[model samples]
Target: MSSKMQRPVCLLIWLFLLEAQAFEIPINGNSEFAEYSDLVELAPDKLPFVQENGRHQRSLPEESGEETDTVDPVTLYSYKVQSTITSRVATTTIQSKLVNNSPLPQSVVFDVQIPKGAFISNFTMTVNGMTFTSSIKEKTVGRALYSQARAKGKTAGWVRSRTLDMENFNTEVNIPPGAKVQFELHYQEVKWRKLGSYEHKIHLQPGKLAKHLEVNVWIIEPQGMRFLHVPDTFEGHFQGVPVISKGQQKAHVSFKPTVAQQRKCPNCTETAVNGELVVMYDVNREEKAGELEVFNGYFVHFFAPENLDPIPKNILFVIDVSGSMWGIKMKQTVEAMKTILDDLRTDDQFSVVDFNHNVRTWRNDLVSATKTQIADAKRYIEKIQPSGGTNINEALLRAIFILNEASNMGLLNPDSVSLIILVSDGDPTVAAMGEMTAGLDNLSINHFFPYL
Candidate 1:
């Protein structure tokens, strides 16, 4: 309760921000790779996050390979991003070419942030007239190979860091002076429909200024695209206009900001292109049953109809008032509760269950979402304070009992939807209690999360 539950900082082998910091690969004067743990005890802010496009103006250590004052010694020549989306599945490839403009060997990192759930399929690096490809193998085989490489004095570093919805992959190499390194990374992911639209997001963070940075995307859907729109990124660097070429079944979207356009200001060297490029669109679904497709003996189907009347829902709000959620967290939750309660439909039946060390309820049973009931719920929420321990499983069981009892009394509509929203931030103090409902049969669970 004394400290905030902040997001854990992921380090290299671990590596975003709209927070670009040069994660210096801890390599000594020799070619051998030093343990990343040996890296200077630099805080996230203390790390070189060059406000000048991450190109520090300070003098480099005598052995850091480069000695330049005007530009970063590692100059990015070209960064090309291309992706082909077929039937909502996209495979994107990112390629970049960089040349060490220093007389001494320097450590350079090739970093990219991608969607969290996406899987990296392939990664390759070419430097000094040789190509190296990374492959996945059994742990034992990988360990044996690593042992052999270490014995032969070969060293390389590859690390990845993750946040809520994005992951950053960083590859570091020690390049000889004036040598060029080409990096290629391939990743794949499916753009699943969320809240009725499909979105494809691309993370763009060219740490330093780039001369040639281009992005090309092609979307092909047999069902045909209904709409395609791109919103302004990074405060309308392009004056709120995004050029998109769209057609019935296919579309093309390209973004090529010139070096001058990439700057934060007219003449400033700092970059203003460190954010997500998003594209949202919908596909045609002819029937309420949606579509069913069969490919190579595999089948996938979707059915979510919106033309019918909205089903009344039996909703239960299980909120946590644990000590971990004391100040700002509780205030935000209270604000969100006001909005959520306001969104409840008049026909919906809802109740509030607040728990910490003990379970408490505003009402013994569900109540219709009349104006008076909603106002009462808001008052109850404002009075709830954070203290004691978390008891998640107990709160959930209480919800089930209330809903079931309403059903038994014939107060619940047979066609009504059921939802139990649990807002908690700590682990339960009780043991596994999900199976406490062994008496109930024919139960199914469906999870719905909103992300754009």
Candidate 2:
């Protein structure tokens, strides 16, 4: 026989064996293998195979029993964030909607991140027109209930976890096919003061979101808005600048993505507001004390009482030298302290108190912040190193004693702005004077500052 004829004969024998094996099925009556028959029957239509007649042929098997349906996954549809800022605090609300695009019901999880130090409350979920609401509970009780629900395999409730600079919360809820679920979260955060401006940051990066995303912020400053500045990154992404009211005491800012804006890269996501939305407003620093600014029948009074002599200030800085502050944290602290010392006025008297397991002070008493004294303070801060455990109680007590002695010497007058800036990364591990509880009580009763 020729070699070509032998090759065809071998191929034919192989094909026969494959066909025989393909038709052999196990008849052990195992229900688990019942689904296998469906896949086998779908081979002709799903597989890419040629027929013997030199034509491409495909056919689906006829229904022998009930037909199975396919389901789609749930997806986020839209997200909105709204903020209202007053003189002291800012209230933010987030609303999101999720849609189940499947033919079968689904249980979906929704997660959100909020800024650190922001108090989150008033969480509500709406499914099928029925609303479920939750409130802030004690940590212990909330944890117990959350655990109980999970152990029972219940698809409900939520959990919160705190990260370095933010708190993340997640919740799970079931939704019917083709139905939409809505969630609302509310939180309040104190406005940050830097230099001469009050700032608020709204984080907008949740994930790849729908086309209808928007953020609206309204700020009402009783001190009267002197200037409002928005970063350049928000040039075309947002609109409606700080529109001051007729009285110039209230302002409104709105940010909405431009759907028709051209993208720099064709494949990149559209120019959505993916970063923090920073809103800064400069207050009228020259306003005299007892000056009133009214808007919409609401009145705000300033109480700085200008025309009097500028009060001398006595400042004390309590710094932490614990193990956790060994690297970047310590470096940043030292740099900030240097800048702060440089900014002190000549009339200001200041002292520095640093602690690890033992307390240390730069000077036994308050010293005027002269050019030489400020330079020396900076040098002392630079030479300090991070080590040992945190002694919060001892360090705070030493600060209090210094302030008291300065007051006894008539350095801290009635009109002076005596301030104590406590900087620490961890709780107290060693308390020399007493336990942490008693120390806190004493500090709270004896030490009170309008701003800390």
Which candidate has the top score in lDDT? Answer: 1
Q: Please list all clashing residue pairs in model 2, or write none if there are none.
A: 289-305
Candidate 2 TM-score, true structure as reference: 0.64
Per-prediction backbone clash count: 5, 1
Best by TM-score: 1
Worst 10 residues of 2 by lDDT: 7-16
Candidate 1 lDDT over 135-176, as tens digits, reads 644444555655555455566444545333347687787887
User: How well is each residue in 267-381 modelled by candidate 2, as lDDT tens digits?
Assistant: 4444444667877776666644445556566665544444566667888888988887888888888887887788888888889899999999999899999999999999998
Model 1 scores a C-alpha lDDT of 0.69
